[model samples]
Target: MSVESKTNAQVMTRVTVIGAVVDGLLGLLKIGVGFVSQSHALVADGVHSLSDLGTDVLVILAAKWSNEEPDANHPYGHDRIETLATLILGSVLLAVAGGIFYDSLQRFFDPSVAIELGIAAFAITVASIVSKEAIYRYTRHYAQLLNSKLLMANAWHSRTDALSSIAVLVGLIGVSFDLIWLDALAALIVAVFIAKIALTLLWDAMQELIDTALPEDQVTAIRAVALDVPGLRDVHHIRTRTMAGKTLMDLHLQVDPRVSVSEGHEIGCWVAASIRAQFQEITDITFHIDPEDDAEMDQEGPTSLRPLRREVLECLRADWGPLVDDAQIRLHYLRGAVDVEVVTSQPVTADVLKSKSRAVWLGRVTVLHPTVGDN
Candidate 1:
């Protein structure tokens, strides 16, 4: 693993461990006080805090496992593990929300279920609100620094607990004024808040799981960066997908047909470097050097059906008197046709180059005379 990746993992681990410790303490206090004081909202909020502990475990494990270096079995690394864990965390929240909603509705309708609130309940609710809010801010800061979806989800999870505690505080005030049903109503509101955050996390994880493309604006920016590379005629067939928060891309680049193979390869490398410099998230790139644009061509186009270099040379030698030696012949395959060049010391004519039995795949032919060298 790179030093940066290892540092990120360590940061995530430290943040989650701190949050877990706070969650464990607050959950026990809220649940205990809630039962003693008959506050349904407080109990529901306590359950929410405990649920956060479970997701904290998920985040820690994902951070450690996903940061491992790529192995032979998995060449792309294990970033997808974080995505899967995010999905699971969302599912767990959804189930917790449903349970809270059902219990709150039942308590709200029952006439005998009464809430008795005192100074103890109010003090606990206030403490929970302050503690959870602090944890939320801390986690969110690191999440943006690392650009981690899983950490972001956990950060929101902590904020929801703080918001739920606010609802509990309001319910406790109402119970103090002899309003019995307000405690259950507060719990129901907490359930709704949990469900909304859970659904959002679930949707984002699903999009990444299915390999959705990056946004259109980012793709356009990528194309612009690629076109700025020198010696590139055009670029086409740009394909992209996101894994975790990183991008993977492949594209086709067109260059001059007469350029040497080494030159074409150098151009491709320059394009890749330019793109990576512009977009830091793009870690993997594959470029296909093309002599011509073949995006609109069929699968069995002339590029695929064209003869190999050796076959083309044998045909040229048999048909043309000037093409007797392979050393003097050069061939370029472009746009489904072959352009041939022949070099010799003997005198040659345009008619001889053109009047030969031309194959359907041949496009243009040129003859060059050896300079300053006697036979």
Candidate 2:
């Protein structure tokens, strides 16, 4: 889905607020319960939950700032704000994972350590897992529905927390089987999961920040939409970028050479409207209308020959016949040459004369009739 309207801001606000409240309460509950029951794993899990609260703030601020409308200074709107926000969320997760790994490593080396597990720790761990999983599922569902990467990153962050609590629960049960070191191992496992999530988010954001184009299939679809327009002959040089959470494109559109400029512009309007109707993600499109593509245009060199109108008349009169002063000749400066359209005074051979003029100027010339001015 694309950013359809400002109503997305309302949806974002609702989700972030719910997440913040739940995470904060859960962090406090686990920390308080772990300290009372002397479970280091639960305490670390609680700290991770608190750390997620920071990312919640990132989502809120990003959602607010990125929704700003386009302005004179920033004509593209504020979309990249969300991209940078996702980057910061990934960075925070990395720092959190580093802390988890370092603490676990220290505990792994120390020989003298005492841990006491109470029934309350078990209850807290199970509750943490179930609650955090609920949060993850809720956030992830909407993130995919809305196609929001920022929201999706936060969802994974929640998922890691849930998985950490599950590890803690398993480790607590392992200690029952006389495997006490499993408790410490659980922290290391949590660190590994968090690191993977961080790296994935960073890579996705990097791709968007670098202005990557859409996939080939999507580009082909865009071309098809353009070509389907009534007056468009071909579409090429299509490039795409995402701006403010929507697609923007610029492409060259081939049009009939004989069409008037006003007609070409009218065709351009239809092309834009048709594509926008076909692809909801597209917010802006730039159409560069061409009489022909570059390869075909190369055949017409130096459109302007610097021939004055007086020189054209003198050439026509000397080469063909006396020009009736009232004959209409229209010269169009094109590509770098002048195209001629004329109603000739000579009745017998205007087509041959027009063809000769076109060959001389290296441009198109059309004689109105085979009969020229008279029978």
Candidate 3:
């Protein structure tokens, strides 16, 4: 694969490994403390952290698969694998949140709960806060640096865990005051926050999976780059979308018809290269070249074909120079009609010159080769 793909994979791997290690440790600590202190809220928070471990694993798997090269089955590569994994992770979070909320509601109605506060539960909560906050900052730093939606989602996931830990801390303190309902209330609040984060992640992932167009500002930037090419006359049909962690684009660019095929191809390559150089997110591009007409605007008669023929001759003279000596400009006044011819000193191969000449005449010229001595 490409250097870019390798680098992204390495970064993702590091983040996922860190997430798994930290979350596993935190989950074990919370579960241990929760069981010792008989705190339902603390236990629920532990379960939440445990779920994060699963998400980290999924991230690692998705990053691995999403870096695969394009194939017949997936012409755009496996970028959407990341989106699919994110969707699954979000759904899992929603389910966990729902379960916690259900349990909290049960406690709310039954009110048959034991209030227990201990040093262990409080220490675990504080540790969770510190660890999760640190992970949040670390993950967010890389997320922004990589501009990865998946990493950002994971970072916010860490934030949600931290928020849950804070709720556990509050609940544990309330239990010390003999207010058991506050513990259940805190659990409910934590569940709500998790649900919110899950919904946001789901929405963003769905947008990417459906191939939604990028923001207007980015689309405009792509067009600006394409139009800046030397021979390009106009740009249209510009499109942009996110695939996996990168941007994919396609556009149609107008150029001078007199330019050779290789020159036109070079212009397309330049436009693509410029976009890739300017924007790190752009990973692929395709452009169509359209030729422009100059002399059509110089003529006076309405819909006259003479100006087109004149433009063709001028273009041939500019392109072929002394090789084309005897040239005749012809025109048919019928609707959507054009024809022109150039007589050169030697036999000119059609394969080498046809497209270039036709492009100059807007695909309306006919070149005739006369006897060399007669010409």
Candidate 4:
């Protein structure tokens, strides 16, 4: 099985098992204490915990289905199933938040009812906070280490539960002060927080489902590695995306046109190897090779034309040595002649310099005037 599959299975197993145990026990305790103390807020919070049990089960189901290997029917695999699950979870959160807000609003309008608080309800809320915090930490640590989006979402879910418990604790204290409206108000705030978390998660997961590109920095790092490869002139058309805890990339590589097909292929393989070695996150790479000339032309224009003046100067220096000082070569391509000027340490006749220029030219380059010498 793939690393994603293993991680999903492990996270789901741990989360489901722990969630069932903690939520079950907390739900029972809160309900029992709330009923005896006549605390509606405690009862509502207990119901929320019960709802979490259902959500945890949903997470496990989603993780399992999402980790399935790619099939003919699903060429890209079932990775987006995790995103679908996150969307579902988000919807669930929104609905629950709406329900909680509505109930809290109704309670707010009815000021005649009195809220009762008990020591047992307060203790249960504290215990729930501790337990949920532990779950959040555990899930978040693994989520980051494995880069599992689904697990990270679930971790925040646990964190929201802890926050809700804190709200419950404050409400219970407000009840002691005869502030009956505070309990419902606190629950409403918790509901709003839950809704916000849901919206954020939904938006992020949707981006993933649509196969959004990885961050710019990551793409830049990949491109930098590609350019570092020997024999590679340039890298372009880099594209990257994430799927099931792995990254996939496709890019175009520019290499010398004179290189053979086998050599180009080898260079591409080396580039791919270098990138993967540097960044283990890249699980798949596809490269298209283009001739360096073709690639340059695609970006700008043909770079084949050399500076004739510079070439002539280089030719003079190579053939006649650096004995010629203040040397300059000017090209008049229209006239098919090169103007050469030189200052020699010793006095040299124009005829001797002309002979040297003709020798250096070897017939191709026409020397216009040796009389253009500075000294």
Model 3 residue 235 CA deviation (Å) reads 0.6
Error of 4 at 152 (Å): 1.1
Please provide, for model 1 over 291-375, each residue's C-alpha lDDT reduced to its tens digit, 9 standing for 90 to 100.
8878787345543578888888777767874455733777888767887777676677546876885677787777878778544
Q: List CA RMSD, all candidates.
A: 2.8, 4.8, 8.2, 12.1
lDDT of each: 0.83, 0.77, 0.75, 0.75
Prediction-by-prediction clash tally: 0, 5, 0, 0
| Candidate numbers sorted by lDDT from highest down | 1, 2, 3, 4
Q: lDDT: which is higher, 3 or 4?
A: 3
Expressed as tens digits, the lDDT of each residue in 166-238 for candidate 3 is 7667777877887778868987998998899999989999998888999989888777877787877777777
* C-alpha-based local distance difference test score of model 3: 0.75
Give per-residue CA lDDT, model 2, range 57-109, as digits (tens). 88988888887777898788888888899999888888877876776677578
Which whole-number lDDT from 0 to 100 does residue 242 have in model 3?
89
Please, what is the TM-score per model? 0.90, 0.81, 0.77, 0.72
Better of 3 and 4 by TM-score: 3
- Scored by lDDT, the top model is 1
**Model 2 regions more than 4 Å off:** 1-4, 38-41, 111-116, 295-336, 343-362, 367-375
Quote the lDDT for 105 in model 3.
Answer: 84
Candidate 1 vs candidate 4, TM-score winner: 1
